[model samples]
Target chain A: MTFLRDTATIFSREFAPVWRDPLSLVFTMAQPLLFLYLFGPLLENGTDTPGPAWQWFVPGILIMMCLSGPLMAGYFLLLDLIGGSMERLLVTPVSRTALLVGRTLKEFVVLLAQAVLIIGLAVPLGLDPHVPGVLTGLTLLVVFGIGLGGLSFVLAIVSAPGGELFYGVTQVVMFPLLLLSGVLLPVENGPGWLQVAAAVNPVTYVVEAERALFAGRFLDAPVLWGAAAAVVTALLGLHLARRRMARGL
Target chain B: MIHARGLTKTYTLKKTSVDAVRGVDLDVEPGQLVAFLGPNGAGKSTCLRMLTGLLPPTSGTARVAGHDVTTEAAAVRARIGYIGQKGGAGEAFRIGDELVTQGRCYGMTRRAARSRAEELLTVVGLDGMFARKPSTLSGGQRRRLDIALGLMNRPPLLFLDEPSTGLDPASRADIWSHILRLRADHGTTLFLTTHYLEEADAMAERVVVIDQGRIIADGTARRLKADLAGDRLTVTLHDPADVPRAAEIAAGLPGAAGLASDGPRLTLRVAAADRALPEFVRALDAAGLKIDTAESSRPTLDDVFLALTGRTIQDEEA
Candidate 1:
């Protein structure tokens, strides 16, 4: 109970400043919103797979939004390190887990808000995903955010004092994940090697699950695998973050 | 309140090892304020960091506030406050919010934290500035906020690293007053590091001088000055020709060292000015050497450092 309270305190501390900066909040949602409006239309041309353009595009945009939330949240940790605030926090009685999970929790919450905004926009653009389906997709993204945000926080610590390396590595990893996970296009229509790579990407399960939900196909294999992947990622990412914090960042 | 034995820290990078702090043993009774004096890079900061449980010691044992630093760091931290050279307040936070958050980190309730923040602000003389952002504060005001934040947990011991390094004289005095007040009112044990010789001499009851990662001298300022360094006597002869004869007489006196003649002035160091000055003057009178002016000055902390290490403390800092 104390651990949860400590985490909440840290979470509020992180959230308060971001809440005051509406412009930055708008910028966080801008990219995914743009993709939903611009590239989202290009999907209307119809792919080799059977699905409406908006249904396919909505899931991809939601995943894209989730990817950015944690990546950007990592910068806060880097800033804290450079500013000596992390050192101050280290000397306190606050648990290392609370310090890490608190920041990631803020990222997860932001991703959920972004997911809501994207889904709200998608509804007017011909998105017909049902209430349960949309709720499930948002839930998956929240869990995925925890995983990704935790990894981002860890990466920030790993490349501390020189954050450019963090950006470079995240970009290298993120682009590949996006390409292979069928966010831009269905992996089945791609080359054989691409299919094999997509099979290995956990995001593939998320994208597939969300796509099925967008099509109103609930209670399917995709949803189960996606939920499992999200939970595992969240657990693994949080665990690594806590371990790195304990060893000193 | 503090005890450490053979506390040491070594850093190894790319097969090159640098020992920042060599074997150091220290003990301080409760409510005693000891000033750790050293030039930059003298391992003063490293030792403080280890003692406060911020950094792990390479080899040593430290018990602060009844908790082993290595094995029970959280307990040690809970019992001590550390005001680092750089202020720890976050740039974005309002002064009050930062203080409250720090208190909460130490497990204080929200109401308790807020009320304590209010009291500390007044204690540090930052009463009406709670709503201001930390970045908006001047150097001295920001340092005071750092002190208030450190005290949020009401720790028994406090460690301040160069607390008044870059402040103006008035601001430096302000910080010193607040520091003394903390000790007087709460009996908080302070272990601070500084290179300012005069401030340490004037403010600290006990001064520990560190050089090149080793404790070279430790004692009360008066005792150190009287034992290691002596009173300085400068006699200005009416004629430059009298310097040679005066120098000879000064060298002949027992415990009169560092005798030098420049122009019409003859200067030398003596163990005690009150006893040595009278006899030296009578000898000069008998020699028929006219004495224009004679003055004796008490030894400063810098002189004590110079007497022990052959290098002035200020020189090392420069």
Candidate 2:
């Protein structure tokens, strides 16, 4: 009970500034919105994928947001660590897990809101709605995001008091994960090695699952693979980040 | 409310290890304002972090506010407040919201936290600035906000790491007044680290001096000064030729040490300069050595450190 209360406290604190200004949330969504309108139409004639460009590109955009959004969540934690606020929070009686969970919950909320906005905008662009399927796909994306957010927090804690390591690691890791995941383009037409690499990349399974789910193929093999990948990532991210929090910065 | 034994912390890098705090043992009674004094990298912050349950010790044990810092860290954290070296309020958050969040972190209800935040803001003289961000505040105002956040829970003990460092003289005094008032009103046991020798000497009831990761001296500032660094009595001789004889005569005085002579000026340390100055003068006068001038001065805390380590704290800081 206390853990939940502490988590709520942290969540509220993390969310308060966003709730106040809200313009910042729009700025974060700007990049995804740009991709949705401008680059998304470019996929109309270029791809041989089964569905309209909106259906194919929208879920990919949501997955992309899930990737970048939660993966960058640690930057705030890094700021707290560099400042004295993190130390202040650590000295309090608040549960340590609550600290990580609370911040991650805030990231989840923002991701969900942004995902909904992106989906709503893509609907007018001739995207058909798969209500339950999209909801389930969002659930999977959230699970994956929680894990990515957790890993990001671990990176933040490790890079504290200087923060160079956090920036360096995130920059070095984000691009490869995004490109390899096939969120923007299909890897099926690529070389055998590239296909093998995509097969191994957990993000590729998530993107595949998202694309299948958005097209209402809930029972597809990619859905199971993506679910497994999401669950594993969430578990690993939460475990490592929680352990790091327990061990102290 | 605090006790520690054999507390140690060591950082092992690639090929070598540095002992940040080595075998520190400390005890503090309730409501005592003890100043932990040291130069840079003297383990003051490290010790504070351990006692506050923010950092685990490399070895040994500490019980702060009746809970083991390692095993019962939650209990320890609950019973103590720690204001770190940096601004406690997040720059992106409003000061009031941060204080209320701090209160909530300690399990206070939202309503209670809000009221306490308002009350503490007033107490710290930041009453009307609740909605402002920390970055907008002046250095001293930001420090006061940090204190307000630390006091949100009203813990029995508060550990402030260099509370008055880098502040102007007027602001330092203002912070001291708030700290002293907190102790006076609620009997908050303050264990604060400080670089200002005069602040520690004037404000703290007990002083614990750490040097090179070890406690070198701990006592009342008066006791440390009188015991380690005695008063100084200097005399200017009428002739530089009489300096050696004056030094010999000054050395013969009771409780005299650190004797030195340069040219016509002769100086020596004594337990009480009042008693030793006149005796040394009479001896010199009887030896047919005329003295041009004589003066005696009491030693400061810097002198105590110098007497103990052969280097002044200011020199070490430099």
Best by lDDT: 2
Task: Please state the i-RMS of candidate 2.
Answer: 0.6
DockQ of each: 0.54, 0.88
lDDT of 1 by residue, B1-318 (tens): 889999998988789999889998889899998999877888998898888877889998999999999899889888888888877887866779888889899999989999999999998889998789888888899989989988999989999988998999999999999999999999999999988889999999999988777899999999898889989899999999888988888887878888888899999988888888888999999999999899999999988888888988677767
Q: Could you give the DockQ of candidate 2?
A: 0.88
**iRMSD per prediction, in order:** 1.5, 0.6
Kindly list the per-residue Cα lDDT of model 2 for residues A1-249, writing each as its tens digit: 999999999999999999998888889888899998898888888755666877887888898899888766799888898999999999999988898899999999999999998888888887896999999999999999999999999998888889999989989988888888887888876798988888889999999899889989999999999999999999999999978877777
CAPRI quality of model 2: high
DockQ of 1: 0.54
Misplaced by over 4 Å in model 2 are A48-50
Per DockQ, the best of the predicted structures is 2
